[model samples]
Target: MKRKHQILTIPNLMSLFRLCLIPLIVWLYHKKEMYGLAAFTLVVSGITDVADGIVARRFNMVSNFGKAFDPVADKLTQFAMLVCLAVRFHWILVPMCLILVKEILTGILKMAVIRKTGIVEGADWHGKVTTVLLYITIFLHLAWYEIPDVWSIALTALCTAMMLISFILYGIRNLKLLKNRKY
Candidate 1:
């Protein structure tokens, strides 16, 4: 009955629920042209994500499944939004590309490192902040229903910078971990 094995519990099911909403959000955005509804869906999904994590921690429900599924759900939600926005705006493709590349590379690197070293990667504070900023930036775009003006650009730039910083921090942390290992 170790904690890591409870990956298929209720909280994880809730996390899966959030992942299931991505298609509905995208459908609202593209077919119905309901940006407001899409934003609302995003907000709901985000809240559920936070709730699932909190529930898992508070109730001692941490499981390997939760760890894996949480990030996968998060990536799916964000990537779904990115694809929808990029298709609609076309101008955001560059930044979206950068973000996706960073995420994918980081994921691959994490897996390889974990396999070699037996250390699981957890989301650090900076990574969490970057995720929050990304959600905010996309939410604002949905709110505005157009290319954001100067303020949004500034905020997006700030968020992107934070994302990069978090990326560097994760890399450094892993390097230190490797140095300390007996391998």
Candidate 2:
């Protein structure tokens, strides 16, 4: 598939909007009494994430820039939020670290795929599911402010499992693509 080089599409703009919301979310989250505000900002962030995807698909505005840029924005947002939460909830580190590792390995594989096949692979369903679950798990902690420990542990386990599954699937896909690359 030919890559769309367009950078100014609405979907891309919304992804940029999500990136812009991160520091604000983190700042509000750190404030002693601003959990609600922080949660609201996170909701806004998640909404924009969903909106961008819809706008991209419905309007045919998907772009090479967006395919790569959107996930970066998401990981940044997730990383910042996870760090903020880890200050109070140490268990947050589990998924946070797994995400860091998954992303690093995925990045290396993506570079290999691009070098060998000359294409950037777009995210598939497993990735989408993992992202959605991550957001939901994070948002739950942010929004509830008093989320019980049991719920926290369960959500973290679920999120970590999803990440692991996605990580393995992505590894397989990237390797398969590289193996099948034409000279």
User: For this target, which candidate reaches the highest lDDT against the unseen true structure?
Assistant: 2
Model 1: how far is 41 from its true place, Å? 0.5
- Candidate 2 lDDT over 1-183, as tens digits, reads 443878888999899999999989987888655888898888899999989989898888889789889999998999888888888889989988999999999989988998888888889899999888888888899889899999988998998899999999999999988998832
The TM-scores of all predictions, comma-separated, are 0.89, 0.93
Q: Compared with the true structure, what per-residue lDDT tens digits does model 1 show for residues 37-58?
A: 9999999989998998898889
Q: Which run of 10 residues does model 1 get worst, by summed lDDT?
A: 174-183
Q: Local error of candidate 1 at 30, Å?
A: 0.9
User: Residue 119 in model 2: shift from native, Å?
Assistant: 2.0
| Cα error of candidate 1 at position 114, Å | 2.1
Residue-level lDDT for 76 in candidate 2 = 90
